[model samples]
Target: MSEALAVVETAGTDTTVPAVSGARQFWRRLRAQRAALVAAAVVALLVLVALAAPLLTALEGQDPTTYHPALIDSARGGVPLGSFGGVSAEHWLGVEPQTGRDMFARLVYGARVSLGVSLGATVVQVAVGIAMGVAAGLGNRWVDLVLSRITDIFVSMPLMIMALALLAIVPNTFPRPVLVALIIALVAGWSTMAKMVRAQTLTLKNLDYVAAARLSGWKTWRIAVRELLPGLAAPGITYAALLIPSNISAEAALSFLGVGVKPPTPSWGQMLTSADVWYQAAPQYLLLPAAALFVTVFALTVLGDGVRVALDPRAASRLRVGTGRRRENRARAAVPENALPEKALPVKSLPEKEGPA
Candidate 1:
């Protein structure tokens, strides 16, 4: 019996339960944050719209690039001629001023451009940051110093100024959208992520598991990949989430400044630029794109904050669960002090039961 017990114990020690993937765990934690969940849903919807932009444009049979001077209300300064203040069944949102293009079609297609640039840039940024950060954290002291200095240089430099200089110098032969994304990623992507990853790696390196891996003669790269990287995922991803909105806003600002995607590409920023002159006549033109940008950035920011809070051990306790307010109210109402006295007290049995028996 003792031998069997010993064998069982050895098996238990040798075969550890498979740990959950970082992505899976992060998702679980994110789901705990209600605001994050809602924000994620909104983000997902936006992504879906962006992905299906072409199909939706086709279904509506609206050409974003084609001019429709006939549809415009010249009386109202190029607002779409319609029943409800330039809005009609034919032209859902309205038409543009000078171009007279379908506003709705442009708006839908513009989502693709904005989301594509932001998402692509974010991916590049996070990947580069994680790689450099891990190397710096795990490498020798000299390596760490060099990488840290490089990171410091980037941190000190204003990203917009650098980007403007680069944009001006770089030839226009490059695809505008791709160039914009690449520029943002290369210029501003890695700094924050790298710092976070390095901090996490430094903390993880001293942990017992990491030390055990080192003692077992595990290769440094293997230890970094298998042990340290998993620990960095939560913080890295949370930071990446936050950085996405920043990238999106930056892209918009650049596009507004005429350094982004060229005309007819249907970017939200380009639309905003076009609407500036026609604000009084066709206010919807300005309002629609601006509102969309605001909502998108706001949602992403909130979601990112929620993710950060969810991933933080200290913040976990503060995360609200269920329909928070309602749940709290119900719990408080059901407490002993709030309940009726009779219901709160335990029932007592009468001794007269013996006489009945």
Candidate 2:
């Protein structure tokens, strides 16, 4: 009987372990997404570099804004600072065309601008979206109708055109990067995030847990905050992660169009804008910033996809099928590494009594 109990307990443990760890399970799921994992690493590295830009520039004793006109090669139409215009001891990525500012320093500093705008806008967008979405989802039909219509109107409007029009009216004295982020967040992000949140809230508000909370006399605010919010986190975060790259790209485009962070600020888009004029003389100048932008966007996109898959087992299965990789790894990812498989759990055998005769 004791041996049988032990076997039953072991089986129960196997079942219980999987349900216990939400964070750990999410991590295991994420680990299965190889592309997403790689993207996350790259994003982390880029962020570190962006954060360390000041330290790196200080170490090099180079000011990004300071022009080294003498370094420019006038003999070659004044495009490069050196013979090759790339990978030199003094300048890692070579100098700007005419200004001759250190390429490495500008690149690093530019990352700061790009990241700052993107991250800031994303935060605002997510917060506003979540608030409006939750409100709409949990509210009565009239409230939902009003908010949903508003969201639809915003969604129908062209974001770029509206932003451009608004930006043109704003005073130049106002901060460009901050202003851009605000415009982008207000115009582009909230609608989509709100829609997603609303859809999720509609589903979650009717769940058993929510019913339990309501039955316990929890206030509406408490129910929304405690019950629905937790359920919304996975989708909200995944959407926000995906939104970041779009925000970054938009900021860059604005800068490229010359309405962004003005000259001497050193943004990726600004660099591209300037590089285009000198492309014939030094194509490296054009390629460097473009490549950085591409990498940043790609990494964010892949990381977002990974997070989405991590939170949803169905998505993970689809990812596995699309990738056409080894099935064993995907199987491992779906299950927590610390937990033993049902077949692997130790079994205690019952002792057999020997016959007396």
Candidate 3:
């Protein structure tokens, strides 16, 4: 008995479960989400297409700026001559209604501008938001007050009006896409991210590890960089993912308003601006850019939601959504039969008492 007990003790002591790193765990969770995976694939394709725009355009034998006047019918209000907006062997998508610029070339090139502006704007917003949020959360009372007020002021400002004013004032010499991105980042939206970060910081600062770090005489900067930033990353990333689609839409809106990327530059919004007039005569012109914008935005939104669920599984549970049903089933299957709850186990009924024996 003593030997058996010793063996049991040694076996128990030696048994160890391997620890999973956060990155691996996150990736594992993200992979389980089918919608997220699909969305990721779409976003990847868009990025790939955007990066390969020049090569694609070269192969199509068309440049976005070159106009083929012969393809347009002046009798029909400058509409493309052939069916479906002049689609042919040469033009995979079709030609523009009036200018006869290759739709495929303009679309791929437009992807570059749209993606670049939104991505750049998102980066700027994240940087500014993190800086402001962390400062407000970690700073003294007076510092917090000032930052909070500043954030409020930013939130209160009308984004469209501010963007228009700024865009109007800036010299036209600067690259329009870059200028639009900067304007979008500066105008509004960062306040929400800042607020979220600030709240998270406040909660994290009061935690035991943070308190221990402070007691160990670590400086504010060091503690923030080492301790607080890691905790902030999950939420920050989730928020940033959601922010991209919004920024893209905002850029499109700006372009639609004639204050966005200027002509000769093929932005989806600018395309839409021109497409409006040709909707009745050549509906294909309007549909193409609109569909592209819709798909990109929809994919991004779904991906963001998946990312949010992956980063915080509890969030899915809280919403009563079955996002992890497959994961849950796999987990359950991995557990030994004996480890299952008693309620889940088969129960044998006791022999019924003989009646009137």
Q: Which candidate is the best by TM-score?
A: 3
TM per model? Answer: 0.82, 0.84, 0.87
What residue runs in model 2 are displaced by over 4 Å at the alpha carbon?
A: 1-19, 74-77, 316-325, 328-357
lDDT of 2 by residue, 1-357 (tens): 122122235645733222336687899988877888899999999999999999998887786898877888777677665565744777777888877888899999999999999999999999999999999999999999999999999888887788889889999889888998999899998898999999999999888999999999999899999898888888888899889999999999988887778878889999998787777778888998999999999999888888888887676433355455566678778888668556666889989999999
Write one digit per residue (lDDT tens) for candidate 1, span 1-357: 112112233645754344565556667877767788898899999999888888887887786899988877777656666643356665678777766788888888888899999999999999999998999999999999999999988878787888888888888788888999999998896887898889888999999999999999999999988998878887888888898899989999988888888887899998887778867777888999999899899889988888887677466533355466897898778788836455557779976645654
Give the runs in model 1 whose Cα sits over 4 Å from its true position.
1-29, 73-79, 83-86, 316-330, 337-357
lDDT of 3 by residue, 213-249 (tens): 9999999999999999999999999999999999999
Model 3 TM-score (2 dp):
0.87
Model 2 residue 157 lDDT score: 83
Pairs with steric clashes in candidate 2: none
Which stretches in model 3 have alpha-carbon errors above 4 Å? 1-11, 317-357
Please say which candidate is ahead in lDDT: 2 or 3.
3
* Candidate 3 or 1, higher lDDT: 3
lDDT of 1 at 71: 75
Minimal lDDT window, size 10, model 1: 1-10
